[model samples]
Target: MNAPNIRPDIRFVWLNVHGGTFHKLIRLHERLRDSGLSCEVLFSVGPPRGLKLGVDVPLERVPELAARGVHFLGRTEVLNRAEKSPARLTVTDAHHDPDLPRLVRGLRARGHITAQMATLLGDFCHHGAEHLLMQHPLTLFFEMDYNHTPEGRGFAQAKTIQFTGNIFFEPTANRLVNDYPDREAFCARYGFDPARPLCLWLPNSCDARSETYGQVIEAVRGAGANLVVKLHPWEYAFKKHGGEHPWGLAATTDVLWSVQAVDETDGTWAYRFCDVAMVRGSATILELPFLEKPCVMLPLKEHVALFRAQANLVRTCCAALSDMRDLPPLLKNGPPAYSPQDYEAGRKSVRIDTTRDAYEQTMDALRQILSAPEELPVFGSLAPLRRMADPFVDASLIRTLTPSRRLRYLAARALRGICG
Candidate 1:
């Protein structure tokens, strides 16, 4: 695809590997422009084959971004143009992009600054090949908070890591407060009872057959609260591809009360209206405290083990359900109250900088990097040398594989002592 005609002296090239990252980048770009940073910005979306299910940025949004003086490009086109383009910096979210490490290295080699910003808390959790990117000496890493895990601390002390605030917080909060000012009107539009406590359930993409999902719905009903469910975008994509419906039997069958299933666009608004939230492996766990809403974590056994550090931190501050039966009483009694004091405490624990909003912090970081000497110095040691032979597999590859193929892949990796 031909690149859109814009200023050739692009100061920032933002690459988005996921739809969520794309939207967050848009927010940051808007802020930078509004703040009178006249530097040209180019937005690039990952190719369809490169992205996982449900994370592709919709093409309809491209024209709108273009109308705002942002040039949009395909992943391949951006990579090709980067070789000779006069862009001063290239920025991307710390998503599971298999090409990130190599791309960062290439850009840095060409005397351009490279940055990877964390859009979610999970971004701090380095797993498998991500360590390669995190440990790179030249690339700058921006995180939502001061990571508490051992791995996170090690990377922070070794690499060029900066503590930026949550990029989604201000935008989401402002939208909820300004766009949907009245909770009653918002509830009425959705046909939800404003009288009952509203519980928003944000499920992971792979939670199609989860038994806990049904239990949560029943628990909300038992507590006499209205339920709003927003499935991961991937779940909707899966359903379109003849996969199991996210609601399973509930999708076809009728229930006693309303189960309003909303799209991704309604997520932030729902967070504002809901009294409490039910989450499993969603970033909403970290975000809810900032909104002053307590969340109930319904962690699957595998997820807890995989994300042990995050699980421990969340379970420490929020209410986590070990037994499904306990959900009703907690919902009825209302989960532990999360106050401004609690938010401050949690902020300190995570080491998030709240003196200014995320957008301003990000802009400041960019200015600092841009004004730095062109000859950037290496900061970290030669640790990336040890993981040279690590089998670099895209996480999406594993997610898209058939059961048999997945088992075979795991077996192959196990033979090489890479699979845990």
Candidate 2:
């Protein structure tokens, strides 16, 4: 269905073109309405370019948001007629889109404020960082904390950065207070044994091998623990077969009997019930530390070096397993004892800002930008650098690279490093 007409007085437009982006944007929208903001806030959904790929709002979630009283807009409608439907500010998650720089330029020329919100922890080392660098000179860049600030990373666009705490924190905390189930209730809902230790497995989207999943299952069973496998959204949307298990797990009967697989977009509620978490170098692991849940790193061979380089703090603060066989022993032994001081230090490493509420800080930053949008200056030189480096990080191109093309990718990356 087509989005309804966008009112002229809308002050905030949130453009979401991916499920993950919508997840964050929706929570922020709810908070904005609850804060009693007088201005109009519209949630705009963009068309997905590929099949089950770039969809902004998942079909199932449309009614959910509508029930919450969020006004809707098709992004094309707003952008195509930018002058007629002017919003004081537009917000999007920090993601790579080839057309983003052009869109930002067009919107700014038409007197609209553009901002990107940080959705992931440790975004500097994630793909979003490369994307953020491409969209420099934004009216505002709402960073999660000090670790994500542009100046801390020596980026040229420091002036555009604002240190807001983790966007997921406040929403998740509220849910825990009001909606979370007790341990017994949670176990009963999922058919987990209340006595056995519960292990939550959050795997990366790229490595969904049946053999690896089988190994994890065996290790969990051997350790006498119950397993809950939370599939990443990509895995659920694209990787699953027409069966109860995702494509990789259909053949394993253990998945049917022993594992509980979940595909929900928001799985934070499960964190409180699980005793431990096992991950394959996903950013989701960063959230576990804040909850005081210990994690076991099960990095794949291809990602070991990258994981160590970017997530060393996670490896140090939590348990790291070099071999799958070691998982059984680690689970059986229970999570390593971490003092409050240890958890506090881990929180600092991820740059969690505790001084104010994240949603409030985000609203304050938006107000500041709307009041004085021209104060944020653009660095002309960095634009060319972004253009030059973008292709090296393009997700589609990287996925289809041949051996010869990979050499070129490496060469381009080296050149970008030297040039920067």
Number of the top candidate by lDDT?
Answer: 1
Candidate 1 residue lDDT tens string, 1-420: 355444332244445433333455567777777777655555564333223222343456446556775555766666666555645666654555555556666766666666656656445432211112221111222121112233333342223445466566543533311256688877877788899998988866434556766788888889998888866644443433434554453342112223557544456678778888887777666666566677777756554543333444444457777777788888888867766776665554343465666777778766666576655444353233212212323343244344675676466546556523
lDDT of all predictions: 0.54, 0.53
lDDT of 1 at 18: 34
Judged by whole-model lDDT over C-alpha atoms, candidate 2 comes out at 0.53
Clashes of each: 0, 0
lDDT of 1 at 130: 17
Q: How far in Å is the alpha carbon of 254 misplaced in model 1?
A: 14
Backbone clash pairs for candidate 2 read: none
Q: Please give the RMSD to the true structure for each candidate, in Å.
A: 9.4, 8.3
**Residue 139 displacement in candidate 1 (angstroms):** 14
> What are the per-residue Cα lDDT tens digits for candidate 2 across 1-420?
333445322244444333332445456666666666434445444343211322334566555555564545665654544445555565544544454445656666766666666655444321111113111111121121213343323344433555565665433532311244578876776788989988888766444553667788888888888888776644454433233443455533334445667434336556777888888757676666667787777746764544554345444457777787788788888867777677666665554355565666777776665566466554333334333335323333233344565566557556766876
